[model samples]
Target: MQTTQFMITPASGKRLIAKALINYAPVQSALESGTLVIIAGTTNGYLAEEILSSIGQLEDFSREKFFRGIVLPPSQPRTENGRLFDESGFPGDVVIVDGKWKKGLTIFDVADDLVEGDIIFKGANALDVHKKKAAIYIGHPQGGTILASLRAVIGRRVRLIIPVGLEKRVSTDLDEIAMKLNSPGAHGPRLMPVVGEVFTEIEAIFCLTGAKAEMVAAGGVAGAEGSVWLAVSGVKQEVAVAQKLIKSLSREPLFSLPENE
Candidate 1:
């Protein structure tokens, strides 16, 4: 097995992540013409939003677009603070609200509207919905469940785009990583095994490690103490290429350490 390693302090993780994303051909292609990119994750939404906002390609569709032809959820009334909350069956580009968790939408809702040039950045559920139509699904290895479900639905169409920070990498094998991360008491829920099962079914896998988020308050990296991100895909050729890229990126540094002082 091959692996890639990146070593960065928390302060530089986010910037490295953004740079790594630019390396993906799918993302670069999608950015050519602003497309609707859906970002999903447990708590990484804020980071994803910030990244997209800095990219200068995000589109905030209003009710008019939803009513016209853009297939999105209805816009809810803005709050006193000008914030919009998610209501039942409400879909929009930007998810800026509070207390707005609903049953969630499926890929079928937006599959018909997805074009070959569109991009998607989502978690497991959203990936399951748009895997067939998505050029690439960007996130961690936990997204395997979505890939497995997508394979059942579309028989392998989407590719994987993984962006990771150096602090998240580990020397353990995939199974061990899954076990440690998904164990009942691990990270608040059982996610590792589920993600592990999905890894076996995907075609391509890309892993990037070298982004650290500086924790201004904690005086260190937010989750950089010991964390990593894994991403898998259902596209074989793409996965093979990604594996090679990961290896190339993981090569040992050529610098030498100084003598003991």
Candidate 2:
């Protein structure tokens, strides 16, 4: 097998990941045929922009300060005296059907019309690479969107697509971690282990390039922290294509957090 090594920066990695999600065969088909629900966060927020805007026109759809789901930890000065500014997900939801973005659709509204074959996209905070499982941070006492979406996704056979980066990979057993954590007495957010189609950068690269990519190394200093290093193995032509894809993403801008976030 042919092997090619790569060093990807964090921000550029997210862009490549976004590109893969937009071009994923199943996702593309689902967007065209079934209802697509996006519970946006920092990572999926980038993807939401990619889905709406064409390549080379990302600037047209990249600003979404209010539409992101983020955790506001109590350690931050923003959280004090039990006042939480946690907006871990957009207050609302976005839906797309027939390859067209539909506005003004709420998750509740989506559930009313949800059916099998439709897709629910949710982001996660942590992934267990060994177990191929993912866990999400929940600020909502009632379990938030994941729980609501699970009803339709699990019960009705709707597809749940989780587009997360390798940056969120965790070494601990997610279930074990969840056991020690509970929303009531937790100093911070509690985690909920989720069952879904977890999409990481490795999967994204394979989906986009048809090449098997492995995480050979990780972490870096001088602004490359949280970035992933991969060893992609494939035929010569496939490796070339993967290289080109990575090149295109090298200049991809870092997704900026909306001011006052």
Candidate 3:
């Protein structure tokens, strides 16, 4: 795989949007036999949904894959106040709360218990548990929490796949990302200082160049115009997959770095 660094301005990058980015081939390739996938983002769960839609696993894909299964947080159940409990029935051992996994837990803790040989969509902690065992996908957030969590769990050799809309760019570095996560105005009611603490710990970073909305459309679903998406995995494959998806959407080039010379 080719690993190179390129700079993209928020204005130019946002133009592409999540609706225009997403390379399914790389993502599809990653899902061979037993690959755990963890998705992270700030939205309620729209980001995760958009990603699944893109990969042909979504029902609207017309041809669904029986081999794929999704395990979401208990809080996001199908019933009323679903976001307050775990409806997915994730084995208690896999779920992590504060630094502890459930009874049957192993690598991941209670909050980090999302795993699958196929793909698993989850929040930041869950992504941490499966970082090495799976791919990671991230979307728009205040900053730091997901990155920091990656650092705590993923360590130095870990890679990050960040698929973000141009709308979510900051001109600052990881430190800046932390500031936003801590700033009262940055994130809404879900105020938690730990979010900022985790973000600052991220040492490895890679940006996935694509739009979430477009990836959702590729899943053959309609009415996905303004939805969010998430995917958590190593940086190399995720960015590569995103580049491929960007190419499929239009004849125009995916991205062009400004002349530095």
lDDT of 1 by residue, 44-123 (tens): 23334344555552354222211101111345233222222323323433322121211234333443344544444443
RMSD of each: 15.6, 3.4, 14.9
Model 3, residue 159: displacement in angstroms?
A: 3.8
TM-score of each: 0.37, 0.86, 0.31
Model 3: lDDT equals 0.30
Alpha carbon deviation, residue 38, candidate 2 (Å): 1.1
Model 2 Cα lDDT, one tens digit per residue, 50-123 = 87774233343434443434444455665444333654533456677767676656566776578888888888
Q: Of models 2 and 3, which has the larger lDDT?
A: 2
Q: Could you tell me how far off, in angstroms, the CA of residue 246 lies in candidate 1 after the best superposition? A: 20
Ranking by TM-score: 2, 1, 3
Give the CA lDDT, 0 to 100, for residue 212 in model 2.
91
Model 3, which residues run further than 4 Å from truth? 1-26, 36-56, 60-153, 156-158, 173-261
**Residue-wise C-alpha lDDT for candidate 3, range 165-236, written one tens digit per residue:** 322222344334445555676543221212211110011122234222111111112433222333323356
Angstrom error at residue 254, model 3:
22
